[model samples]
Target: MATQVNPPRGMRDFLPVEKRVRDRVLRVIRAAYEHHGFEEIETPVVEDAARLHAGLGGDNEKLAFAVMRRGLEVDDLRAAAAPLELADLGLRFDLTVPLARFIATHRSSLPPVFRAIQIAPVWRAERPQRGRYRQFMQCDIDIAGEPGITAELELLAATGDALTRLGIPDAFIRINDRRILFAALDHAGIAPELHEAALITVDKLDKIGPAGVAAELAERGVDGERLLATLEAIRAGESTGAGGTLHGFDAAALEPVRELLAANAGIRLEFDPTLVRGMGYYTGPIFEIAHPDLPFSIGGGGRYDGMVGRFLGRELPAVGISLGFERLVDLVSLPEEEAGETVALLVDKEVEPTRAIAIKRDLVAAGQTVRMQRRTKNVTALLEQLAASGATHFAFVRPGDTAATLEVKPID
Candidate 1:
């Protein structure tokens, strides 16, 4: 029996065409960030297990992929208290944690206020589904050490530039603050101990309607009725709508939300008081990018003034945004690759190998993408394969024909 060849569950394998789109989109995003004065940086895919499991990751820590301690004996495995006990390192679930550590490690050499670009793949042990993967890429730009609301605004502007450059319209960002969320809890008389759990319940308000949330919260031995009523009023777009002053918001948190709405230009941003980002590290002013055509957010981030401090022992203001690469790639339709003509150089079997190499080399040097292939009897099938592999045109190299004399024809 032949062995089945496939990628591991929840992972994916991209063909040549798919990879071309992915690479092009990544370049577009990277170019946008750099144009906004953000410089790219890289970090390892793995981090210390202790750091990965810290409270900052929220629910993501449960889904992290742990790397077992090296050189573990059978005795070590048997005596372990839990699965994670045998693991010393883990694949990072998100870029923020690793970036926090990176800044802490290299802060002295970096600028006073650093704008870093991180475009990389992160791993999560998620149940495989459409637009959800165990491994995927995140395009993130973060500003650190800027304590003011400027960092949030800059992150939003940079992300908007990326989406606009990709030709996506109708995308808007919804802003909120963790402080406001807690303030709402305080106004409703919810205990501090139940705040986190209560917020988790509220986050699901969309999936399960008010009735469902009320039921669940009641089952949790709490009355969320008044909180849900206030949330419904907020969603009704009464006192707080786009580009309008917030009325019922907490007095201190009110001004920043107003600034985000009034100052946003490149994209439409609204105030979503109920927008509870899942990450536990967020301190203030959270926002998420949404499109009218999609039911879920395509990107989101917020201020985390204390994450770097987890490593540096002192909190520094940090704000960032990440575009969901896999989800957004489907919505983008870029023009076909136009940098250069992709040419397949077909040479006869009797043609000298050096001649083919010389022709391919010359074509490549002349700013054309050239792939050399031996001429086959099934020219139609060969041309089909080449075109599927991203060839735009083909040239037949005859025994006497030089590079200048070959006849070129479009594959289509």
Candidate 2:
């Protein structure tokens, strides 16, 4: 009996149609990033475990897919063992971390406010679900430089523009500042020490409703009154006044956010106090884009001013945003007819190699996916078989022809 083979859990193999959809999604993202003056860059999939550990904060430590040295044993004699002090690499958990490392190593060769777009796979050891996967591609855009809200707003606008262009309607770009959330927690009487844990709990308010969040808080040692007060404060922020004007509040900590929202009136921006992003490194404004009909967020990002500084010796203020390519594709319903045609190139065996190459190039140049025919005997029969295989366009190459021509023959 042969051993059964299968992809590991949480991993996926994309078929032709699926790859086409994914490629289309990436094309849109690449165009958007380039339009915004972001230069694309690639980094190694694996990095030193120490660097990955230091870059990603505490919670991510458990999620890292660490690699161990082969043939190393606990009982190996100290005299014969080579130093394994630097267990120098593991798969990157996210693109931003590696970008930070890249900047630090090549600081002299890069611009001051470096703008980069990275699209690559990131691995995690999390359980898979509908929108979540252990190995996934993250499309990231980050600007590193002077600390200001303009950079943040620009990224936000880019995200809105990209999704809107991708035909995703009814999507909301939810905005909130970590400082504001922290201040609200303070107002609600939650102790300073409990802020991180409380925010982590609050971040799940949407997924696990208010009741569920409150229960979670209690489990994490939050009492009923503080949780209720915090919830009420968040609700208050969601209301627009009778005159359709936003309610006034102290804007010192949220000044940057307020200005950006006021300027971008057309953006579907909303301020939700309960929007606590689940990353320990987010030191300032945090935002997430969500679709009303979708169960997961389409994209999200926040200011990580200290991340770059961790690798570099100096503070490199930076902000980045990542688009959930898979989730975005899932939300879009593309029309079948508008999709590109898949051409099956049926070539005669006696045809010179140059002719086959020429035909393939022409089809490709005309915006078609050309699949070379493998079998040559009974060409007509093969074409008939291919027609039933969902390929609509067929290119038949005879031994000698001045130019390729399409002959539509009625099937009997």
Candidate 3:
């Protein structure tokens, strides 16, 4: 017996119909980004291990898919001091990091402010679940060299337009600035060093709830009561449809963001005080797109002004938004098959082949899809085959017809 073959775990093989739907979705998404003046770019699927494990990718760093050293480099594994030294490169977990490296490497040749659209597959060593895969596509748009809230506004606008075009009915763009979060922690009397520590716990607010968050913060020896009160106050604030204010951060700080939201009609904005986007690299405003139907974010991104500096010698402010292509695809309806008229040209075995060819040419010229097939006495089987191939119209070229005239009829 032969061993059964299948796509590797957490990967998939898309059939023709599936690929069609995926392509259509990609087109819609690409148009949205391109319309915003973003040019497409591609980077290597493999990236330096040093960068992958550099603690910049947030929790995703723990899930880096390392590519083992090969050829002459394989010898180093035997004498390497640590696992990190054994592998030179690994599959990229996200597009943002690679984009930074790309900018640093190609800055001189590229525009000072690079607006990029990266649509590619990224690999991660994550535990796969429904709507989650080890290998999935990410559609991202990032603006490098922009140092203001205007960058965040443009990123959100492009992202929101894309989702709307894709037919995602209702979604909330939950916005929060990391600066505000840090200020809130500072006001709560948390030490500067423990700010990230508290944030890591607070990031689980959506999953664990305030009580769970307080309990975890208490275990960390912080004043959980103080932190919980801060969160509760912000959550209970006035429902402005746009996001409300956090305690320590003055509401005036968000005036620019609020003004941007008011002018951008059709954008459902909400200032979520507890919205802690988990990524460590997000320097300023961070946001996530949430729909009531899905348990997870369909898209999110934020300003990472320091990431480029970490690679390049200088700090270059940048902001980006990424759509979860896999999760977004799951929410939208698949593209339906077009039901255009099709003609299967069934030529009798004894008929001159030119007769059938002429009929097919005529049908094709008339804007109908035509498939040439040999005529068979088994009418039932022939009809079944035509129906299976989705041929809506079929034609018969009989051997007795001297003029090669074809009587084309509806498949029904």
Best by TM-score: 1
lDDT of 2: 0.75
Model number with the top lDDT: 1
Clashing pairs in 2: 48-88
lDDT (tens digit, per residue) of candidate 1 on 129-236:
988999999988999999987888788888889999898877999888888788777766788999889888988977997788889888876688977765555546
By TM-score, the better pick of 2 and 3 is 3
Better of 1 and 3 by lDDT: 1
Candidate 1 local lDDT, residue 149: 76
Ranking by lDDT: 1, 3, 2
Alpha-carbon local distance difference test for all models: 0.86, 0.75, 0.81
Per-prediction count of colliding residue pairs?
Answer: 0, 1, 2
Query: What CA RMSD would candidate 1 show?
Result: 2.6
lDDT of residue 118 for candidate 2: 94
Model 1 spans with C-alpha error above 4 angstroms: 233-250, 352-355, 398-405
Clashing pairs in 1: none
Candidate 2 per-residue C-alpha lDDT over 207-239 given as tens digits, one digit per residue, 9 for 90 to 100: 878788789878877763565565455446445
